[model samples]
Target: MKSWPRPEVPTITTADFQLRLFDTADQVIKPVHMPATGPVGMYVCGITPYDATHLGHGATYLAFDLIHRLLLATGRDVTFVQNITDVDDPLFERAERDNVDWRHLGTSQIDLFRSDMENLRVIPPQHYIGVQESIDDVIDVVQQLLDNGAAYIVDDPAHPDIYARRDATPQFGYESNYDEQTMAEFFAERGGDPTRPGKHDPLDALIWKARREGEPWWDSPFGQGRPGWHIECAAIARRFLGSTFAIQGGGSDLIFPHHEYSAAHIEAACNEPRMAGHYVHTGMISLDGVKMSKSLGNLVFVSKLTEQGARPSAIRLAVYASHYRQNRDFSTAVLAQAESRLDTWMQAVRRADDDSAARTLIDTVIKHLAEDLDTPGAIAAVDSWAAGIVGAKDASNASTELTGPGALVAQALDALMGITL
Candidate 1:
């Protein structure tokens, strides 16, 4: 793949508010420093566009969108790249069930996904590449891996495919933080055929799969086949962000074989020790104590919520009210609470005064968000500020003091949380 022109990283003038991120590889919270000369590169795993936009999907994307907003607020240029797995097995299966062409299904869902994101005020990535469009690049990376002896052809009579040698890369499970047993369990849950007879190791991941009957196939050096799920991300990231980027983000569920193998493939292809500066994974969303899944039929679709007249800002607030790395339960009660809090903030903003109280509240919120995106803390700070504003208004003639503070609060909400009031 050809190298992309890196954007110049601007000098950040915001207060020395250190941004802390939980690096999955190191398993610790570390301060995130912006690069001096180029844009902060972020690659987030996007949707497959087969299912409805559920709360799980909403939470993941909003988490990254928060990061994107903060980076820009700190006066840094960010080149965000999110990939769409348009040609994956799930999409194909869903298309077959719906009796529609897979490509057409993908296109329709992509449009719907775009609409949902826009409605929620989630900023779009600068580059949104699809797997089907990047076949040549994916194939290039696969061939490179093969030539470097990092990957091998596995020709089982039952399952002919290209597999990445897990042992070949010492850092294969660096980000997963899972033991062998736990890895095996989650790997199976996340689409790993662990018991397949011909794989060199139980953890060996498929890099390329030979075309099967009725499946879409692309001509490549490895013959008529498509890139494996993990390899598609490696290829797309390499094309946009080069060998090493600032951050690689996805849901915690992908921490296992998906992200683990993605890092392995990119490092093997580039001959670099690190694929990304940081690996950040968001927490999962569950309903009634069970993780929401399409198979389980327990999904809370964002489209349905909006269609039923739920405000987009309320949904966003509901997700942002919790820490990004903590599991959240999806329920109407939570959304109602978020809506109430959003309303309180909006009211406070309307009656804001340009006083020390409002400025102090804004500073506190910024500080909380800077420290590992403590959104709950930020919301609390805003809540306290709103309470004080309301109290002051009721006690005395303080309407004159609110105009400046109100405008600042509104600006902060929009700039920091994408909440326009």
Candidate 2:
């Protein structure tokens, strides 16, 4: 007998890869390849610890958690890290408004974030790094940029700022896809206050910022201060995952100044071409046909959603029922639909006891999922399979299908949607 050859492992490719709006239209993320090899190094831009985690945050993180699980299931040893922006400007404002110590507020909100994650069944990151714990890393990156002439310190007594040297890198707007010339023209055309502290160029962003009275701080190379909003993520991501990682995911709002500035800082500090191989951003969650945002006063607190009798599974299903990149309108009706769909799958699984029908449904759904994590397509596939089983001509085959792959289909669908049996 001839010796058998070894089976080649399947390689993940960017073709038909499911990606969302990062910073630009053309910026896309592919699977980890040679230079960027890893157990799928991933960094999700985490919450600012000021308020309770909301439905939007739930949608975003659950999406990431699904991707993380899928990557793991695909045989990648994943190291997922998420940073808590525990000491940003908003924390101070909220602290002052609430008349609580900044440290206390940070601790409280971090607790809340953790609690919310547990409630939603979103897995915690392998590393839950917070801005306060990683100040030294933040300072080190800032110092690197300064040494490399990609950063400069401003001395305004009121609110000093460490600005990235936008002129040093021609690729400042590379991630954002904003034309530098156009940006300059736009800024020049609309001049604001000329003497505002640390407002040198409209495009320049802070790497380090002086602490305000009653704000958090640490002794840094720059001064007694805190890291800028963007720098915190860069430092934390670099410290946890190497300079180059598989993917960076966050809300679509972070695309511009936040993720863009982080990219510049990483390039300056690490002297690397890419901070992350691909940047994945999720769309906003809306309420009642409008965007659910705190500014809009239409935000649905995760706590409140639970109070209103929304199961975490149902919420997850509703948001993910549509593509992650598509704007998801959050309403009770949508949740009802998700609940209904989940019930159908559960019932089908309960009835399924054989392999053939169940296997057919599972195979079809898996194929659709492989197509760029096309979950909507996959869900439709499940619906079709269930419908077929219900309409099967042979009663014996239908029963067999239910016993076999039909049950497996429910497990698979639940695995994808974080829905429980």
- In terms of TM-score, the best-performing candidate is 1
In model 1, the Cα lDDT at residue 159 comes to 51
Per-residue lDDT over 156-239 for candidate 2, one digit per residue giving the tens place of the 0 to 100 score: 766777877665566677765767675555433332122346655666767787777766678976678888777888898888
lDDT of all predictions, in order shown?
0.83, 0.70
User: Model 1 over residues 1-421: C-alpha lDDT tens digits?
Assistant: 1112322222222464667788998998887757888899999998898874888999998888888878887777899998999888899889999999999998888887887887888878889899878998999999998999988888675456998888877766777778889888987888787887788888788888888999988887777888889999999999999999889999998888889888889998888888888899999998877889888999998999999988988998899888999998878888899889887777777777656776777778888888888999998888888887666675344343335768777676677777766
What overall lDDT, based on C-alpha atoms, would model 1 receive against the true structure? 0.83
Which candidate number would show the highest lDDT if scored against the true structure?
A: 1
Supply candidate 1's per-residue lDDT for 132.
79
TM-score of 2: 0.85
